[model samples]
Target: MIAIGWVKVSVCFILSSLLVACTPVTPPHTEYDWKLPKGFPSPLVPEDNPMTTAKVVLGKTLFFDTDLSFNQSTSCASCHQPKFSFSEPKKTAVGSTGQKHRRNSQSLVNVAYNSNLTWAHSGLNTIEQQILIPMFSEDPIELGITGHENEVLLRFEKQHYAQLFKDAFEDSQASYDKIVKALASYVRSLTSFASPFDEYAYQNKDGAMTDAAKRGMELFFSEKFECFHCHGGFNFTQSSQHENQRLDLRPFHNTGLYNVDNMGAYPLSDQGLIEVTLQNTDMGKFRAPTLRNVEVSAPYMHDGSLATLDDVIEFYAAGGRGQGINNPLKSPFLTGFELQLAQKQDLIEFLQSLTDHQFLNSNLNYPPVSH
Candidate 1:
């Protein structure tokens, strides 16, 4: 009886120790070595998705892996090439299996800071969620893995990928959510803040920028042109952004790209934000992408309608194609401002100044192939 009583006391002591240890202790916040360039604001990072070196490495591998596609043909780099600032030079991107996409692949530049992704769809919020649409969608199929999900997962279940999956995720088994997380993490790391304009404007270098670029900057910020209304901020993007930011939310705009049939109707082939909301007023409305690296991402606009920076300037100078005739959503601010030939050249130079050559040849290129 005495021995039994001693055993019960020992059990009680162990339980008491475990309870003391289990008392909720707050974990210390990890400090990331974030380097915010001059005039650049801090990027919004979700608390649940903290940045880690291992996560970023895994994300990078997933991003460049073509195995994510239906037939293991096209990777994210297939559409969003690193050379074009993560945008496709083609008006519409071709899928892994030679399927042509309807809309041009949007640039991933500064997308980490964007509040909403895509040209018009508000349904896409997080990069992780957005990656799935292209990976699994059927209508206007992107990666073409709709009916072959099980097959795709099985391919990834190989011993070669087992270690990669285990390292990236907290679980033993690889899943779709873990894939999305890795891709999103890699994309978020595609940050660019070292352009010539960045060195000149924010760094205050006396002669970092050319005289023409300076003139163009003046024109861009001048009240007459009012270019800053939509393209203002450190990132040169309209306000759409995520948390940990001090800026206002971005609003989608219809820059009078079209008024087909003399009515306020955009082409059915590409109906910007109207696709998701199904509202007439939302027709031709698209999120204003950042002008950073704008010069290289030519064939401008969502449809790749504009060909060159000069042509873009001319389009904006004329306030879109319709002008003041039948378009309703045309910004009242754009009143067809007159720019001289010299000023136009200067503006183009300034746009070119935003290009970061280093980013174009980044190591994010496709992995080396084996013989």
Candidate 2:
């Protein structure tokens, strides 16, 4: 009886041990490893489309796959190239069907944090919605997927993509909703935070930036330059949001890029946010893009009018371009400021310091197979 009682106690102990061992050591979560820079918070994610490694893999493959296009002539990378930090050198983007877009392709670096997507469209608050314009906008005919969506969907039904879809969505069926979600996940993963500025500012590495760049950084944040008003914070723009910050300012400003009619009016071809809102007060208003990878993604402004960093600096120094200087709707911060030659060089150096080579050189930035 004593031996049997001892055996029962041993069995109970073993069962309890097994139960504890079988339990998860750490809590299970849907959180993704963003590999974000120190002190940088994770980007805000949609509740419906939680990020996962499988989605990233599938989305990355689709981002570069020309098969997603109806004609297979152009892919997302055609406009947003990896070498240029996902923004091409073109003044304006040309669609798959050879239709021309009005605005330049914005860089995708750290785009996940942008409060507003695109330059002037206030309605386009999400990357998933912005992506649809390129895929199916009949007026611009970007990927020309409007009528051929069925055809394009059929192409991804192959075995290779089937497995990817299964892994991403637990279903092997390829649909546009899943495609957009996957692509969004891939774009969200395209972050750049390894720049010299990040080192000096965030990582406390004093020697990362040069003296001139450091001086320029001070000047950039100073009241005299007033650059921080529009282009400020970690991402260097007011139109930014993250995990800790729920501020959806969606700030847009009229930098007086153009004033054709001389009545605070932009050109008839493109009038910025006024067209969307049909409000004259919103004339020439556009979202201020993040300056994270500005050095690599050249040809500045919404129209890509300024060819170089020097030209952009000069444009702001002179107040605006052509008649845009005297425009009534220009931002209050656009008032011309004096920048000496040495100071200009310093500012340029500081802007260049924002380049992130690590993010640019990552193999993940490249297509699965060379395009």
TM-score of each: 0.85, 0.88
The candidate 1 region of ten consecutive residues with least summed lDDT is 20-29
Per residue, candidate 2 scores C-alpha lDDT tens digits across 143-244 of 889888788899988988999999888889999999999999999999888999999998999999999999988888887887777787888888434343
> Which stretches of candidate 2 lie above 4 Å from their native place?
1-29, 239-250, 363-371
- Candidate 2: the clashing residue pairs are none
RMSD (CA, Å), each prediction: 6.3, 7.1
Query: Tens-digit lDDT track for model 1 on 103-196?
Result: 7888888778877878777887878778887888777677888888888777667674677776656444667777777778778888887788
Instruction: Tell me the deviation in Å of residue 70 in model 1.
Output: 1.0
Candidate 1 lDDT for residue 78: 80
The top-ranked prediction according to lDDT is 2
